[model samples]
Target: MRATSRFLLIGLASLALAAPVSGQRSDDQILPKSAELQKQGRALYSAGKLTEAEDLFETALAVDPRNRGAFVDLARVAEKQHLFGKAIRMTNKALQLEPNDADAIAIQGEAMVELGAVARAQQNLQKLQTICRQGCPQVAQLSAAITRGPTVASAKTPETPKTN
Candidate 1:
């Protein structure tokens, strides 16, 4: 009876470990409510209501943290806010969900460019090229951003007055 109980305990433990793996959602399985929230967020973003859009995007993520589109949209909002580092981090989350996401790579590249990380942006561009060999709008967008270079505000530093 002792040996049987031990075997049953081990089996239950293994099954518990596997339960989470089974519960994990696939990349294609975004929650519908999250998608709806993301749609609303996109409309708000397009209408120049960035704060409202950000709120909706955050809600979408709360509903479904795996909503890769929401992550990408949040990154766009961050870029608009001139929060380049946050934008990069948001795109990194989307990339984690789908490594071949051209939009995420492009957005991340643009944010990197804004931060004056040209070399890293170039690498992201290369990755986009590899992922979209047939050519894509993201490729063009990222290329244009690279050509534009970093914003003047990002490049400039305030000068301090020298004390006698």
Candidate 2:
């Protein structure tokens, strides 16, 4: 399994240098190096190097300003760092660029849950769950968190419930 994973990693690294998609305007084209940097940023994010990931993501954005992936990535790193306002801002920026972005919506929804905006989080989660055609497993986790959070935080006992 380790060898197979290594081989797949090398193969993906090679493919990261492939040409940009057609129909992308010249200004919107993501160069191979930027794509590689973005991939590296994601790896760093997954490894919990939020500061390093944010730096690499910013570098990728400097190379390609219109990269929605960078914005989503930045939001996630910020969220991991507990910078909810920054996360929310970045998520909003990503949504403006790609309004139907399930990933961005999900990120915002998760952030809202943390920020105690229960109803708003529920609304965004609902939107994400609806359009998430291919079974968003992460959204499932978020759904569980949202449902469990209040139950855990709420006091179950009533003040007048003492029985004689």
Candidate 3:
């Protein structure tokens, strides 16, 4: 009986091990509901309703964590709010979902420039160049952002009150 039980346990273990592992969904496999939310967010964004757009983008991400486009849209809203760090982080999430995503790379580079990380932005620009040898719009966008340089506020120092 003991031997039979041990054999059964081994068989069960083997069966469990043999079960197919679920692989990650591809970048294009976002759920329809999530995609719809992302579309609504984009329309709101275009309408200049950044807060509403950001909420919709966040909801889209909640619906499907793999929605890279929603992450990119959130990054755009963060950029509009002058939240460069948040934008970079959001773009990083999108990049993780699709490493070669041109929009994510370009947005990240732009945020880096806003944060005065010109060197890092240049690296992103170079990466975009390599990814889109045929010359995509992302390449031009990042290139123009690099040329435009960091914002004046990023370079300015806070004025200290005069000491008596």
Ranking, TM-score, top scorer first: 1, 3, 2
Lowest summed lDDT over 10 consecutive residues: which window, candidate 1?
147-156
Model 3, 32-119: lDDT tens per residue?
9999999999999999999999999999999999999999999999999989999999999999989999999999999999888999
TM-scores for every predicted model: 0.84, 0.69, 0.83
lDDT per residue as tens, model 2, 68-152: 8888999999887778778888889888878878888878877777778879888887887788867686578668757765332
Of the two candidates 1 and 2, the one with more favorable TM-score, higher being better, is 1
lDDT values of the candidates? 0.94, 0.80, 0.93
**Model 3 segments more than 4 A misplaced:** 1-20, 23-27, 152-164
lDDT for model 2, please.
0.80
Evaluated at residue 48, the lDDT of candidate 2 is 85
Top lDDT: which candidate number? 1
Q: For model 1, name the residue pairs that clash.
A: none
TM-score, prediction 3: 0.83
